[model samples]
Target: MSDPVAGSTGTAASGGAPLLGAADLKVTFAGRRGSPEARAVDGVHLDIAPGEIVALVGESGCGKTTLARALLGLEKPTTGQVSFDGAPLAYDSRALKAYRNRVQLVLQDPSGSLNPRHTVYEAVAEGLRIHGYTGDERAKVAEALSRAGLRPPERFFLRYPHELSGGQRQRVVIAGALVLDPELIVADEPVASLDASVRGEILALLLSLREELGLSALVVTHDLGLAWNIADRVAVMYLGRVVETGTVEEVLTSPQHPYTQALLSVLPEAQGEPVVLTGEPPDPTRIPPGCRFHARCQVLASGEAERTGVAQSCRTKELPVLSAAGTAQVACHWAAAKAGASG
Candidate 1:
C-alpha cells in the first residue's frame, strides 16, 4: 500500500533510474490519396522503473498499443526518443537485436502467439535460438517454464499448442519471454483472451515474476480492475495521449480527469450511474483542435465546465501534456480550475 512512485523523477519510483523511458514520443501513419496523417501515438512520456509495474489504461485507439510498440522498437516513431537505462534506443538492426534481447513483448492472445505446429519446448526455444543463446538451451527453457508456474516442465515440453489449455498456452508464451532473461516486458492485454477463471492465474504469474526476477513491465490494458489488482501506478490514456496518471489508490479512487472518472464510474464496484459521454472517439486523422477529448467529455456536457467558468477553454484551449515523472497529475482545464478555486 505504499506509494510506488512517490519520489519519481519521471524515470522510476524506486529511484534507481528508469529501466525504460519515452520522451515526447509520437507515431504517425501517413495517409494515401492526400488524406491527413493518422497520429496513433502523440506526444507521450512514460517510464517504467526497475521492479515497477505501470498500467497504461485506455479504450481502443487511445494509442497505448502504439506507444508500447515504439518502446519495443517495433514501430519507428515519427518523433521523440525512447531510452533504456539512460541510453537512447538505436534503430540499427544489430542494436535492435541487442535491445530486444533485454526487452521482450508478450502479445494479448496466447493462442495466436504460440505456433500450432511446434511443441511447447520448440515454441519457448525460438527466442533463445533467435538471440543466438549458446548456453544450455534445454535447462534455460525448463527454468523459464517452471518460473511461469508450469509444474513438471518436461511434462508439457513435447505437447503442441493445440494440446494445451488456454492458461497453459499463456504460460508457455510467458516462458518464451522469460527464457531470454529480459529486464522488461511489454505485455499487451496479457490476459484479455483467457476465460474469467484463468485470468487471475495469469495475473498472479506476472506478479510472481516481478517479485522473483526483479522485472519491470508496462502493461497495456483497458481494465481498471486489472490495473488495480496488478499495477503499482496507472496512466489513463485518451485520444492518443495520457489524460491522467497517479498511484492506483490516487487515480482510481479519486480520478481527476473526466475521461478517467467516467471509466472508473462504470466499473462493477462503482456506486453511481455510469457517466456515458455522447458520440464515439474522434477520428485520429482529423483530431479536433484544442482539447482532443472535448467532444466527448461529460464534464462539459454536465455544466461543470460552465460552473467553473472554463467551458470556453475546455473547447478552445489545449491543455499541456501530463508529466511522466510526477506522483499524481492530470491534463484538464476544468480540474485545474476547480483545484485552484478550492485552494
Candidate 2:
C-alpha cells in the first residue's frame, strides 16, 4: 500500500543549498565535582546533503541526542561549531527563531508535541505566526495539512489533538514541522513509539518529504531496520562519538568499527551483522582508555589481560581515526587495518 504521507507530498525539483552541517563539533558536559567533565560530543563532523536522509544510529546514551541538540543550538558546545548553509546561529531567542524558520524538528512523541488545548490549524500555524509568515497564513496552513494527509483538510483543521489517531497525530507533528517550509529536519527517534504498521509509513513519509521539499534530515533511531529502509547514509555513534560512517550499503553490509560490528551483529540476517558483541559497553563516565570497545574485544585479550588491556586502552593512548579514504570511516584498530589491507 502506498503510504498516505508519500501520497501527500508535492513533486518538485530541488533548488536549495546544503541544509545543515556540523564541522568539528564538540559538546562537553560537567561531570562530578572532583573528576574531569565528560565529552558528550567530541570533535564531531557531519554533513547533510540536500534532499538526503542520514540516520545517526546508536544505543540510548551515545550522545546522538546531544548532537541533535547542538544542531538545534539547544546544547551549547564547548568547542567546534554548527552552521546552516553558511550562517552561524547563536543560542538565543532571535537566533532560535531564525533557526526555527530554516530548520525544524519532528519530536518523538506526537501527543506531547501538539498542544491538546489548540486546534490542529492553530498548532500547524504556530510556526508561521512565530516566524512572521504573513502572506496567506490560512492558505498555507490548509496546504500543509493537505500535504501531510490530514485530508479532507477542512474537517481536520479545526479538530483538537485528542480527536486524532496516534498515526494521525504523528502526521500532525510532521505537518507542523513542514509548515514553516524548513530546509532541514532533526527527527529524534520519530518512530520509536509508533505501532509496527505505522513505523514504515513514518519513515517513507520522511523520505518522500525530503524528495519533494528538498529537505536534509538527520534521523536518530536505534532501529537498524528503519535506517535500512530509508536512510541514504548511516553514522554509528558510541559514547558521544561517531565510531563509523558510510553509505548505507557499506556500513550495513561490511561495518568496520568494532562497535559497529557489535551493533550489526545483533541485527537480523536480512538487516546486517551476524556476530553480536560479547557484553555491554563500558560506563560512559569512566569509559575505558585505549579503545572503548577493547574490554569486549574478542581478539584483544585473555582474562587478566582483558581487564589489563582495557586499563591500558583507557590511558591517554593515541587512538586511530575513522577514515573514508574507502567507502566507510571506521575507528577500530583491527577494522582500520582490515580496511587498509582490502584497499
Judging by TM-score against the true structure, name the best candidate: 1
lDDT of 2 by residue, 205-226 (tens): 7777876777778899887767
User: lDDT values of the candidates?
Assistant: 0.88, 0.74
How many steric clashes does model 1 contain? 1
| Model 1 lDDT tens row, 1-343 | 2233332223445557788889999999999999999988889888888888889999888888889999999998999999998999999999999999999999999998987999999999999999999999999999999999897999989999989899999999999999999999999999999998999899888988888898888899999888888888899988788989988878888999999988888888887899887877746787777778888989898898998999999888888877678488999999899899899
The reply for model 2, stretches above 4 Å from the true place, is: 1-18, 32-36, 270-282, 298-316, 320-327
In model 1, which residue pairs have backbone atoms overlapping below 3 Å? 10-325
Q: Write down the worst ten-residue block by lDDT for model 2.
A: 3-12
